[model samples]
Target: MDLGFSQATAVIVGGGRGMGFATARCLAEDGARVALMGRSPDVLEQAAAALVEFGSPDAVGVVVDTADVGQVEAAFAEVGERWNDGLNVLINTVGPDAVGGFEDLTDEQWLAAVDGGVMGMVRCVRAALPLLRRAEWARIVNFSAHSTQRQSEILPAYTAAKAMVNSVSKNLSLSLAKDEILVNVVSPGSIASEALVGWADSVGVDGSDPYRLMEAIDEHFGHPAHLPRAGLPEEIAPVAAFLASRRNSYMTGANVNVDGGSVFT
Candidate 1:
């Protein structure tokens, strides 16, 4: 697909690995100048190198911990400075995956989950608003999970945090619509990102065989969607790229599901 992000500036939080990296590559391939922000300098460097290899010479890696508001502000400032034209896309993929039931989580753990997942996104978006406003048109794609729709006992805190994200995205969509800034959410299901594959490997699944690993994951986690297998990071990228591009003019405030057929909404 022709994403049409050429000469556009994109800021992807948590872009060093997994689905974030995949989205970065997709945008970069479409000629967007991308800034990848993460906590790991090594991983960010590698991701930036890969983008450069894939034809985004202006791709940069910015070290920023999204959980920290100051860092988020600084990161966006740097992005604005680098891309003087404006910020066309802001894709926030930062969030803590909180496992364990309600009783299992302590006050600290619950606070951490809210801090990392909800407030982190809040801070980043608040900081990026100025840059986004400068563009002719801007797209804000916040990450959510399909688990938020179906609900999960094991991921109570995580689910709550993502649910908050969905709510905020919808509110922001309405608030920013007049500015021509489209805000939407992408809720993914069981995607076989690198992190998921590593977990499968640790659990003795045949990670080498995609089909086998996905089958095992389905048996355990259950991805009863249209496709029999788990989705890939690459599979989620096109949807994200589309939502983050100029082509998506009328999709604000929508939570587009990229989880196979897991959640119909």
Candidate 2:
């Protein structure tokens, strides 16, 4: 059961909520020192406290704006100083979903998606490079969405940006192979999270019952997955944990889909 992550240090960008928080809990439960980096001070504090409660007493909350280059650099530097040992894993889950059709999207909207989705990962990876190099083994797990595989009319720009992220991850995998640093991507499909619940509420669906909300989403958005319903954050966390662990020594540049059979390999 021990994935050998007890002493490894993981920096999770956007670790305050949803899948990021779930992944944080996974690593922490396996005894990793986790630093949650996000923009919200309160959420970061609460998340870090929750991690500590989950058995990672050394968990830290790092407030960072991924879109800001300076903040990203400073945050990583602080993580290095705080951990002092090394950074074993870097998980970039900070990205925005741009809704609306291609024609409805303005130049500003397109740029926003690129800036938040693509450039955010770029900045985080650049900042974490030095710390990651210090570790004996390093893993970079980036987030993409299943929407890239099954295009959505409402998410053209977002999907394009995620495709770019997947491409960049593959390139990084090749470039970092010599260093023995593994780089990969995780594309999740319709994972039940707070955002989804809010979405359901906005559309007059019952948010209290997650399954009902998921069903509503599937009805509205069409779930092509073999599974009957949406996935939970916990369901996606274990895959990310394994990918971020030393056990995943051979898998690199692979975009693993946690989409409940919605995406075919």
Which candidate number maximizes TM-score?
2
Residue pairs with colliding backbones in model 2 are none
**TM-scores of the models, in the order given:** 0.95, 0.97
lDDT of 2 by residue, 56-162 (tens): 87998999888889999999999989977679999998777688888999999999999999999999999999889999999999999998889877788888899
Q: After TM-score superposition, what is the CA distance of residue 176 in candidate 1 from its true location, in Å? A: 0.3
Residue pairs clashing, model 1: none
lDDT of 1 at 13: 91
**What are the runs in model 1 whose C-alpha is more than 4 Å off?**
none
Question: Considering every candidate listed, which one attains the maximal lDDT?
Answer: 2
**Model 2 misses residue 176 by how many Å?**
0.5
Angstrom error of the Cα, residue 97, model 1: value is 2.6
Candidate 1 lDDT (Cα, 0 to 1): 0.88
Please list the Cα RMSD from the true structure of every candidate, rounded to 1 decimal place: 1.4, 1.2
Error of 1 at 206 (Å): 2.1
